[model samples]
Target: MTETTKQPIRVALVDDYDVVLTGLAHMFDRYRDRIVICEIDANAELSDQVDIVLYDSFAQPESDRQELAALVRNPRASRVVVYTWNFQPELVESARTQGTHGYLSKTLPARELVAALEAVHAGERVVSEPPSKRVGSAPGLDWPGRHEGFTERESEILALITQGKSNAEVAALTYLSVNTIKSYIREIYRRIGAASRTQAVLWGVAHGFSPDHHRIDHWLGGP
Candidate 1:
């Protein structure tokens, strides 16, 4: 008797930023035989039925139970996994309580990410070891404002501001100090030639800083 080959895990990437989801989708390119990116949803509905929905938590509130609950309730997704940089104990427990199958770190390499997803698809609840405070984002990831000389963190701050998040709200969401958020905002203003928050919002809106609401199916040749 011959053993049957396992099928690649169908995955849907979920996030509000197109650049963030697209960059994440690229990380799985080398693992195409094991993971197939079925959809890339940006503030959009999960249209396809997939084995896993990898929710990238970029520029989103870490403690958003409503969003997590919605994903968990989606019948199209067999499981929901959080891909985040913030690993606060409360946040992890909240995700678990909300029925997330995995709470993975953003510092995981592409290969390790694929393996973790495989474990999730195999019915195992996977959680990555907490990454060090000094660890940055995984290599080869991209975000908006990269071409404008904004670091990923700075871009996140700007993106939040564009979404009408106050300085305190941004601090709370990203776990950054208010002073630090202000400093990043100052630098963002300088780089974008904006001196006021309204100006910054206008600039961000014009420069693709707002959250997207569409699917990037074409990235993986989906119809």
Candidate 2:
């Protein structure tokens, strides 16, 4: 008797920014044989039935469980995983209590990310090792302000600011110190020629820093 081959895991990427989701989708390009990207959703419903829903926590508030809970309740997704850079204990615990299957770090390499997803699909709850603050982002990821000389971290801070997150709020969401958030804000202001938060918000609004509302199905043609 011959053994049957396993089918590729169907995955849907979810986020509020198209660029963020697009960058994440590209990370799985080399492993198409094992993973199939069904759709990239931005502020939309999960349209396809998928084995996993990889939610990217780009500029979103980590403390809020409303969106995460919605994903967990969706019947179209068999497993929900959070792809985030913030690994604060409370956030991880909240996700777990809300029925999130995996809490993966954004610092995970592409290969490890795929493997973790495999583990989740195999009925195992997975959480990545807590990464050190010095660890850099995984290679080959993109964000809204890369071309404008913003590092991924800086870009994330700017995006949150654009969404009206105060310094304190940003610190709370990213698990960074308030002074550290201010330092990033200063750099963001310098890069964009903005003197005040309002100016920076305007610049961000003009430069794709706001949340998007659409779905990207072109990568694999259609969901």
**Winner by lDDT:** 2
Clash number for candidate 2: 0
Backbone clash tally (model 1)? 0
Clashing pairs in 1: none
lDDT of 1: 0.90
Off by over 4 Å in 2: none
Best TM-score among the predictions, by candidate number: 2
C-alpha RMSD of candidate 2: 1.4
- In the range 51-117, model 2's lDDT, one tens digit per residue, is 9999998898666799999999999999999998888899999999999999999899999999999
Q: What is the per-residue lDDT of model 1 for residues 95-152, given as tens digits with 9 covering 90 to 100?
A: 9999999999999999999999999999999999999978688987888888888877
